[model samples]
Target chain A: MSNLVFLPILIPLLAGAVTLALWRSSRWQKRVSVISTLVYLIASVMLAQTVSEQGHIVLQVGGWQAPFGISLVADFLATIMIVVTAVVAFCAVLYSLVSTPGTHIKFGYFPLLHLLLAGVSGAFLTGDLFNLFVWFEVMLLASFGLLTLGGERAQMEGAIKYVTINLFSSALFLSAIGLLYGSVGTLNMADLAVKLQDVEQQGLVNAIALMFMVSFSIKAGAFPFFFWLPASYHTPIIAVSAVFAGLLTKVGVYALYRMFSLVFTGDIEFTHEILLWVGVLTMLSGVLGAASQFEIRRILSFHIISQIGYMILALAIFTPAAIAGGVFYLFHHIIVKTNLFLIAGLTQMLQGTYELKQMGSLYRQRPWLAALFLIPAMSLAGLPPLSGFFAKFLVIEAGITSQQWIATGVALFVGLLTLYSMIKIWAEAFWKAQPEASGKDISLPLLGVIPVALMAAMTLIIGLYAEPFIQLSQATGEQLLTPATYIQAVLGGQP
Target chain B: MSALMAVAIGILFAASLYMMLRRSIVKLVMGLILLSNAANLVIFTSAGLTSGAPPLLDKVTKEAPVGVADPLAQALILTAIVIAFGVLAFSVVLIHRAHEVVQTDDLDQMKDTDQ
Candidate 1:
């Protein structure tokens, strides 16, 4: 049971290898990838269940001691993330089977998907900062492969920008880890949690913390560092974009949440203050960017930046309730954002264009598509009786309690702007009576609709039955706030 | 000696940043290489300057050698260098492919998606 953490990382890695071996046989690749993700889903659920009931589970690779060897630790926060990764990865693979062109599958799309899952899992579970960097590289390489799979001109352009920026971030991440290891003399996170408290060189520590902040902010698609995101995110195949938007930036947020909570809490006043302003700019600019875009995917790409702002705002506040709100938002945004991209893809399939001016009759021709799209889109806009409303409400409540009035105001304004852009999408794409041209084709199989509908159903389920999810996030947030428990578990309760 | 390596790392970082700011995609790849090597050098120097002594422990007494280098830093750098090499290789190929498709190396002209 305690070995479940390793299973999530291992299954995808093994499946990726299998898929690569069977790449010539697309049938085998699909079978292998789907079964592997299903197995991962089951394992992650078991891991989450065990962590919820039992405490954090820690495994030192090769039976080495915690500080000396690589450690894989599954705390509540990590387990929930792994579970979410499993669910999203499952939907993404199913959608890829129908949406990804045959040329892409030949280029090893399934294998790359599994490799990305392995990377996300590794990032969530590693107890050492260096190990985290390795997992990031794993994810970067795999995403690069997927980004350029089809070899299209637009995809290559997007891939070039994406690759350049991400590689630069990787360099930054490495340098930060090196400096941190030099200053603290250890890379194990739990050990750093204790070691950093004893260091009196406050300025140096804070400088290194800022380095981490910038690196992660870029990854999270936050403001002042989000130019690459909107430039490139829309160029990929829908399955690729859906998974990337859902899980990639969230990994960045999770890293921020982890480091700030565990190791970099020495000078929260300075570090988190910077984070707060970043949140404000990111939210305002991201939504404003969305409003100005005419392409459907372009709008959603910008919203990814905007939504990242909300999570950072919660993190900047750094209260337990605020962190809980951030966690809830993270889960909600992954499902809703991914579903939006999937719907946009299906819309392109049926409506014959990605431009808002040319798109129409989606609701009239396929009311069911409109309904499915509405659930997540409105949820994204924080409409009542949907998941997004509760997510934004919790964060705003936390802000109000903490007297963060300006940020609270900004958060509310962003929600309204979010609704405006979503309505823009609704009116332009769905509610419009018809386009000027009558020759537009709307032929799409129901196979591609399954993943979108499934994600929408999840949004509805979580929105209506919000209690259990809220409790889980609260528990996850509680675990994040109290780093001592994590340290104790990883270090065998050693002082 | 370690201070000298630190100076070199700083120089490398500055050079790479300048290169990365250029318009040419190939130069951008060069910058990425230099930047990654700079990071690896930082890791190497951070473990301190060692006089190339063996890090092995004696079987007879199980005592570690004096002035021996910390092998851990070397190990970390080795891993980083490998990862960087993989990324750099992929990046070069990506640049080449992108150049083939778009027919230009200037990143400014690659503005098809923003509109």
Candidate 2:
């Protein structure tokens, strides 16, 4: 059963390699990509079930011991993340079949996309710090390819900033790993958790934690470190941007969750306090930034940053309930945000532009699309009986219970501002009269609409039936709050 | 030796940051290369400056070796170097392509995406 832990990573890798070999046949590439992601989704569900039944699945690669070799450990948090990733990847690939240009597909877009998934899964599963770094690089390289695949002028401009900032972050991550390894002789996360407790240089450990915080902050698009995200995310194809928006920053948040909960707990006052403020500011700045943007994708890009703040706030609060809320928020946000992007792509297909000013009469032309848009859009704004409402409710409730009044207030304010932006889009893109000069409407493809509708249905399901999901998130939070189980599982009876 | 290496790494980092702050995209790439190299050096220096026998076990005794330099640091640095090299290659090609399409090397001029 432990072997199943590797399936999510392996399936995507093999799919990527096979798709690369089928480069000349875009038809086959599309089939291989979609089938593999479906398989991955199945594997992820199986892994999640296995994890639920048997606390954690730990696989030490090549039969090496934990401290000396890389380990893949899938706790509840990891399993949930893997499942969500597979869901998003499957939807993105399905949407891509009709959305991505044939030229991009011929140029290895599917392969890169699969590789990116592989990297994301690897990062989630790896129990070694350096292995995580390696996975980050893998994801980065594949994303760079995906970003610049079309080589459009705007893409080139965005890619430059994206590439530079990510490269810098990777360097900082590596340096932190080196310094950490210097202080403590192991890179395996479980071993580090054990060793970090005994290291006499507490201040040095705090400093190193800050290094990691900054690096991940950049990756997660926290308040001051988020410029690169908005600059690049909107430049990619909608399918590409959708997956990136859903998975990429969340990976950083995942890392922060893993590290802060497991290893960096020594100086919680010093580190998490900083994170608390960072999260608050990130929420404020992100919402304000979105309120000012008229471009649909750009607005959503800023919203990603803002929502990231909520997750980070949950992590910063660092209670079991808060973590649970963060987990629920993470899952809900991914589906809703990705669905929103897919809907934006549909509008672009119909209106021939992502600019809100150029899009209009969508409500009348395609009422179904408008309704689909409203499902995710209203869910995003935390409307009742929706996934976003429950997600936000849990987080805010956790915040109040934790006595984080300012954060709770800001969160409520951000929700209002979020609604304002959604309404702005509603007014400009869906409700307003059609501009006379806008291009002729292109019919929305069924394939593209399927992913959007499916995801919207998922949002409704999660919202309407919140008990099981909340329980699962609570379980994930318990697992995260208690790292001893993780260490014991990975180390295998060795104290 | 450790102090000297620390100074050298600091200088490398400073130089890279300076290069990266320039307006030219080409120079930014150069800074990235330097930054990665400096990071690799940080790992190398931090792992201690021991000059000892190879970290291998004796064939007969299996564990008789002593005073062996740490092999793990070198392995880590090697991996980092390889990954960095691949990234640098990609960035180089990306910059070349950007120069062709966007028709400017000035980083500040590539603000069209923001608008």
Candidate 3:
């Protein structure tokens, strides 16, 4: 393997160190951070291209082989995730560059954000399950710093709940790893895939699988584990919230797809049913929560959980088309969710608050911002010709194809309620008029508008040119369903 | 020894659950600690009991492949212990900040402002 294999992980980490070590000069910190992220974006794109052409790229660190030392594998799925992560992180940084100025909070948020992205990218690319846990800790720990950056009382309260729940989840995840290792004697995901195939103890495998699901589901904020989300997410600054809303829960979903398809495929009957029901319940609860919320970010947070249900539902179907739809939904949701959160932040910026009741008739003042937000909002509700629509269409079509009538029915109902929730936001924030003296008038810079506009355009573009995405998603899903490609890459072909 | 092991598991389970069920923030923190430690013990016991041997080699004979404890479980348990401690410390500071800033310990007090 080439040395460049490590650059994707190294570049941002080095940048983080430089930023933190040289914190005295804000100018140098900004320059260092921005340059590194741009480099990371380039490296990740190149890595994706390399993987697309050459298949899976594996790097064993410290010259140690797999199953003993950590390995980073850039398979098609991981590469695609990395590329999407780069796009989101790039846009987030661009938005924050404009939004961060003149704020009382220190600029240390940038470095932490970079480290968080590095960790997320690492998690997606790493082939080792233990490495995934470590990367998750890296991201969440950095997030802990970023979430409490402003030192606001509400943010502190929310951060405590956020960190506590995540900590508990991490503990459960570690325990699961211990049990899985004791059972299978290997922690490498690919090696586990092979070893678990021969394991006869169905009950023990199911127990460990459930433990893993509980851990990831908490991160994903599925039903019965979503209490931490609405409590914490709304308290962060708009820029922070937008980026997190777009990325964090998706990490959980990614883990679910990774482990279910890879490590625990033999016992599908037990896991699939639980996931399907969880998906349905999560969707219903999220939409209901969104419908009842008056605060802008809170409603968006609820919708985040609701949208995750769609992805899980697609996975539950376990068909090629359904899994493909799930992949499509994951891609579409990331872009749409991030852009929506950005719009919420932009709204908060313009009106100086996030309460829909306090700030009304926004379209009259900022029609363009309203348009930017409106597109993604409508798309999120699965409006026709938008990315969200295509995503939902594929999932629903898969449901119909698989004869999952109940799931299909639930998805349709959720879509309708989502539409209702979107309209509620539109009506409360844009349709109703507020007096001039009620809210402060604030103007965001043009640079801030560029990232949101770019993402919004990408969302529309995905909806329009969905064939390539769907094809890519299909190929990725095929590779996932058939584990030979992965197994061969991890375990040498001596046997 | 078997009875002691059973009692240990039982006590760990009860204390951890009690801590976890408490509504107070401090108790919640303690609950997580107890729960994680209990989990570590479960991992320890499930791997089998090795009372005779330490992992280190004998110093006097300098023997090769001497009787050593089960290394893998100990390594796994050690990692778990470290992670739990880190999380506990982070939670402690986080809770303190929440208390200082919000001037409240009751999580219910931190409900939605609009409500």
Deviation in angstroms for A52 in model 2?
Answer: 0.8
Question: Which of the predicted structures, 1 or 3, would earn the higher TM-score when compared with the native?
Answer: 1
**Per-residue C-alpha lDDT of model 3 across residues A281-343, encoded as one tens digit per residue:** 899999999899888899999999999999999888888888888988898888889888888
Which residue window of length 10 is worst by lDDT in model 1 chain B?
B45-54
Best by DockQ: 2
Interface RMSD of 2: 0.5
Q: What ranges in model 3 sit over 4 Å off?
A: A1-5, A101-107, A436-441, B1-10, B52-67, B113-115
- CA RMSD, predictions in order: 1.2, 1.0, 2.5
What DockQ does candidate 1 have relative to the true complex? 0.81
Q: Per-residue lDDT of A128-174 in model 1, one digit per residue for the tens?
A: 99999999999989999988888888898888888888888888889
Pull out the clashing pairs in model 1: none
A201: Cα error in model 1, Å: 0.2
Listed in order, the DockQ scores are: 0.81, 0.92, 0.45
**What TM-score results for chain B in every one of the models?**
0.93, 0.92, 0.79
Candidate 3: Cα lDDT at A2:
42
